[model samples]
Target: MSKAKKKKKVTPNQQTSSSKWIFWVIGIIAVCILGLIVLSNMSKGGGDERAALTYDNQPYLGKESAPVEVVEFGDYKCPACKNFTESFFPLIQKDYVDTGKVKFYFMNYAFINNDSSRAAEFAETVYKELGNDTFWKFHELLYKKQNAADEKKDVLTESYLEDTLKEVSSDADAKKVASAFKDGKGKDAFDQDMKTANDLGITGTPTIYVGGKKFEGKTIDDFDQMVKDAAKENK
Candidate 1:
């Protein structure tokens, strides 16, 4: 019979060396995984850097002392803004603003047309002249008129603004508001809001912020949860 070849037996030291190599490989992988996790957390934290929450002479709705502040950078002529205002705003108003949990502010980011600037100027005029109560009324009216203008494909003219003001409030100085539109009385305030929008890096309407965090949510439930989270953080 042919002699069988002798198998090389692993000595204790060899077995230990093999075990050490395996452990070294596992240690490298574990360290790599830990590094990845730390980097991921750092990236996420960097992306959520707190944004500016207030601006000089900004118009707001809700309790001034509320724990959370929700800011909306929006264009009056943007349909998405109108939809948000008409749909989500009421729910937010009831749950957060009305409940003294949040303070809401609207800042102009007019980009669509001169009509956008015009509408923003008019809204600012109403806010400046009529105070918060009437400002909210005019706010809703402007969006309604904007929707109307969309369907009619008509320019939001000086006459349209005047008529809308009259419809908004019997006490509204329609002539004065119109004259402000003509003379550009609210131009400074409008420009200031625009600057705020630019500084905030807002490129679209309905960009919302809660507690200096950009709200990336699209539903009412998301909004509710965001508010709750902000409230918790403040506490």
Candidate 2:
């Protein structure tokens, strides 16, 4: 072939190669953009807004940034209510809550009136001082000392609940916090908590929910399975 003809042919081949390179670059950029969007959504915790509310407004104890929130409504005088707190709470804390899988909010039902509030106050006082970890310690103690609070009449009264708290916690604040009952400060908080429970129509104690569905069971172990079930539902 002549030298001019060969040069023209070479120019056309170079143009085709350049076009192929441009298409490959565009495909690579598109894949990178899609991957980034997926990663951004995952990092935002799947878009659940519950993360906005912290251990504020209520006696909450756990990771504020957890993906799931387990809200419990309970009265201290009820045995089944005790059962859930005693058995399930620790498990959830260890298996899920402590690991940032779930957050916890204890919505005080005060079903037994001021006495129940007194018990709850003990937990709150601990949270104020030692934060969430200490509150968990006191909670386990309350259920362990269940016999003292088992009786309906005594456990439902102001003075008796304070005495119950005194036995479990040696913290100086225990006495101060318990004294809220005698001064009527405890009664006010208790009333407000009970009103919340009534508004929710929670006539029973130890009412638990995972993603807003109540856990139904006669014992704590029974609901352990339910916790697993609800967690799956959320996914």
Number of the predicted model whose TM-score against the real structure is largest: 1
lDDT of 1 by residue, 98-202 (tens): 889999988889888877877788888877777778788888888866764573344667777778888877734888777766787788888888888898778
Q: Please, what is the whole-model Cα lDDT of each candidate in the order they appear?
A: 0.82, 0.63
Q: List the residue pairs that clash in candidate 2.
A: none
**Per-candidate alpha-carbon RMSD to the true structure:** 5.4, 14.5
Q: Positional deviation of 22 in candidate 1, in angstroms?
A: 24
Candidate 2: what lDDT? 0.63
For each candidate in turn, the TM-score is 0.75, 0.58
* Candidate that would win on lDDT: 1
